[model samples]
Target chain A: MDGVLKIFKFELHNLSRSKWVILYAVFYFIITYGLFQFESSQSRVVVSLMNTTLLFIPLVSVVFGTMYLYHSREFIELLLSQPIQRTTIFWGLYMGITIPLSLGFVLGVGIPSVAYGMNKLEDVKVLGGLLTMGVFLTSIFVAFAFLLSIRHDDKMKGLGFSILVWFFFGVLYDALILTGSFVFADYPLEKAMLFLNFLNPIDIARTFLLLQLDISALMGYTGAVFSKFFGGWMGMTTALGVLVMWTLVPLLVALRIFRSKDF
Target chain B: MKSVINILLFSCFVLPLHAGEITVHPGDNLAAAITLAHAGDTILIRKGVYSGVGIVINKPLSLVGTGWPIIDGEGKGEIFTVMSDRVSFEGLEIAHAGLSYIKENAAIKVRDVRYCTIRNNRFRDNFFAIYVSNSHHSVIEDNLIFATVKRNTSTSGNGIHVWKSDSIRIVRNDITGHRDGIYFEFVREALISDNRSEDNLRYGLHFMFSDHCRYVRNTFRGNSSGVAVMYSKYVEMTENVFENNWGPASYGIMLKDINDSHIRGNRFANNTIGIFAEGCSRSMIERNDFADNGWALKIMANCDDNKIFKNNFIGNSFDVSTNSTFSYNTFENNYWSNYTGYDLDRDGIGDVPYRPVRLFSWITEHQPASLFLLRSFFVTVLDLAEAMIPVLTPAKLMDARPSMRRIL
Candidate 1:
């Protein structure tokens, strides 16, 4: 545990020193602040910010996580020769990337929303939900990136697969759902659609944030079963559980792969 | 000076001598008192509950209550039926009129009465609050009508119902929890203004075959199906607010088979469909604000020669949707918040024509379950692709001159 903490601290320090992390954080802050300034309606701002988060957070987390894992290969080999356990090194590295990315997101969007007087109880809940979704997305994508990096020996293949996974989840998954519903238009597809929504992390995040916003247009479109489920606390907890699974499953798989890999 | 003093003495003393005053107490029979009273007499009812059913006042007299006198109909029949001209009924609380499939019972019924006024009354738990049939030049104002029982449309009656009534003025009334808040059938030259009608089973206000009528500054909200103006001509609806009439088959105002009308300066918000028109022709729908509705305007194929211009369409899911192929209606200079086209020359009109219909709307019209894909990124992509190559949507349904900024 002590060794994990030491490596985690060192990795966090290294990430803070990188110019790309600072630049990414600054970009997110400016874009979020610009959106709030441009639109006074908080629901519109939440929707626009949610779209940006869903698209970019996963992209940045995957690419940055893959590159960091690849560049740390020498450092991992050096630490393997030392007195650190494999599990410790793995968890340390995972926390190292996830924490900073989460913090960057919170500071980028959270600060601006708060400064703009999102102080109402409902507004605070919406902002908190958005920030939480962003953190979970970052962790889940970074864990997937780490798994891809450890499974592939070639750095180019690792980065390519990371981008592919992001594209599939971020964009193609919705297209496939759309097509499936269209083809099965005659069937009672509500239960199937709800289950399919659970399969994609981006969709889960979108549903969670959208439920908080409670825009009537979107709510009117959601099926009665889905609305009944996601409109209450049980549904919220279930969604959060799924997001946690998305974060932990890839992470545990990466840890297992790292345990037996030849350096 | 001497003639003026004599005229004042004659007006005060002689008027009272000719028009006698009859004071009816709680235990007295109101029908007997009304019968014994002469024409132009005043029957003042004291503050007490009077259980009377089918009280017919066939003479021209004034029925005034000092306090709000309670007239309970005991669920039996119509409480007060006025069959004479120049009658005035005011300051009464009428309740529990009988419900019948045959007889159109009401708390107060004015039948073929001319120059009558029904004002300042409270109607409770009545099948029909005020029913006027074949009555002309009557005024119904300052009344509160509330129905306690919730019934289906077929079993319920309207709050204020007028049939074959001409030149009637309905003002300053509040009605709720009825089938239709205010209904007019073949009522011509009617002025309905400054009334609030809400939360009814069907339309807040319904007009059928009513011509030359004008309704202004009224508010209709939270009703099941909102207002309907059908088979009417030369009807002017101005400055009314229609809001929160939300359901699958609800609308702020549905105009069907209406002609030569003007719907101007109204606000429609949070309705299922803001302004729905079918077979409506030669109407001018201008300077209205439609906000946060499912569809701002659902103009059907049968509507023709209507001009929709200078309206603000804000935050609606679909600004304008139609099932028509050919377009005779003109949509120009309306500010649509969803328009992404640019006004490069800065003329405040978009350089490209704005098509208000979307492929998704067409899809939803066919398969309503596809509405679940609303606001999805893929749906947006489909919309953009379809906009670039218009195949499914009607080609002629485009706003030729779309305003760049909100008109109001």
Candidate 2:
């Protein structure tokens, strides 16, 4: 446990010094403020931030995290040659990168959102949910990046792969389901569509934020179908649990992958 | 001059006139004609292509055009303006105004008026068809607005644009070949119903920050995107038909940050994606029919606790696509074309819980290209395995209160 703490502190200090985390947070802050100022509607400002943060926070967090892992490859090698076990090093690095950057992420989005929420105290629940969501989602990306970094020492390739994964999960997953549904139009596949939503992490994020916004009606038929099948507390908890899975399962797989990998 | 004599006759009520009548000829000034007209007067333009400037009204007046009178801005100035209470413009064809993205230049502009009506006008080759700003209690219905759509650049013009307006009724208008069919920004308490919107480069209906509005019985067909409603509340969308909106990322209705609304009795068919619901909550979706969509509904997993009940799900390839399970929602009494559950006891409700989502959805959500591995035996086996074991998909995402019979 002492060794794990040492690894954790080392990685945390390394992540804090990286310029990319600061850049990412700064850009996020600018875009959030710009959108808020442009649209005077409070609800709209919150929604845009919610969607943008979900996409950007994860993307930037993963990139910086993966790059950090690659940059410190020689240091990791030296440490591995020393007394530390692989799991301790991996967990330490994961916690180190996630904790500091997660703090930065909160400050970047939370300050403006809190300021906005001051006027609209009714939206405290939404603001809390958004902040919590950003933190967990960032952890997911950070963990995924650490796992990817373990495979390749090349920062560009690792970053590119992370982006591709993000794109597939973020944008293209929904497109494929839609395209396949069209390609096989004759098939009676209503139930299949419900099962298909769990494929993308962004969808899960969207589900939480959208439910909070209270505008699921515009989702039309399938949203209606989902509301029918999973419109209760049990259904919502299950949906949220799936979101946690989107974060945890990948991290776990990445952890396991890192555990067996040779430096 | 004969025009001056006619103007005097028009003002003196010597010529035959009803309600309020003013005539605009090439030789006469439109502003002068408007100045002579009183409250509840009709400004009639003769059958000639006149290239005079815009006409502004400050009273309850009707601007009637006879024989498709053409109003050209002459490339030097603005086209027209209606700035009074209960102002109406009809039966005129307007074209050729300078495009100004900053200053909204329209063929007809209605500003800061109450109870104004703009109908039965044909807009061709104009920067903006009908632009209403800071106006209220107005009706813009049954106008044909066609603007040039370019694939090269984005234009800020719309067929019918309403901004910061309230209690406006827009209905039965055929808007096509424009940047947007109908657009509302920061508008409230309006009703947009029974409009046939088609073949626009952008969304059929694009409105943001507009609240307490109702879009009912409108056919949003064959646009780049059917309709996009973002960041609003208490909006009722019922009995609208969303069809034939196809693209790489197209949907019948794209809703973002909408809350506490009613989406009922709508028909979604033959769109790339029927309805894309993101970041919405506590909405009541009931009695809508989903048929032949590429994907019926794309529910992003963050959405929760919204009731989806009594809807007919027919022939969609993938009914509900999300990254989460159906845990925090209630899906009951919905008729799924793919529901294989049996009503064992002769009651209308199904005997067992129906899992609307399949294991295939979970696989595709994580590994999208695995979609190319579609129809393989591995997909089926994996799906069956997951269904039997229930590992990755949420355990409680099933519909325990499944109805045996179709509600609709």
The number of the candidate with the highest TM-score is: 1
Worst 10 residues of 2 chain A by lDDT: A214-223
Q: Which stretches of candidate 2 lie over 4 Å from their true place?
A: A1-263, B1-19, B26-28, B74-77, B148-153, B404-406
**Model 1: per-residue Cα lDDT at residue A9:** 98
**TM-score per candidate:** 0.90, 0.57
Q: Write the per-residue lDDT of candidate 2 for residues B177-259, one digit (tens) a residue.
A: 77788999999999999998888888899989998999999998888777898998888999999888866556899988888
Query: Model 1: clashing residue pairs?
Result: none
Q: What share of the true interface contacts does candidate 1 keep?
A: 0.14
**Worst ten-residue run, lDDT, model 1 chain A?**
A214-223
Off by over 4 Å in 1: A1-9, A40-43, A77-89, A125-129, A208-215, A218-229, A232-237, B1-15, B148-155
Q: Which candidate is the best by DockQ?
A: 1
The superposed Cα distance between candidate 1 and the true structure at residue B179, in angstroms, equals 2.2
Rate residue B163 of model 2 by lDDT.
93
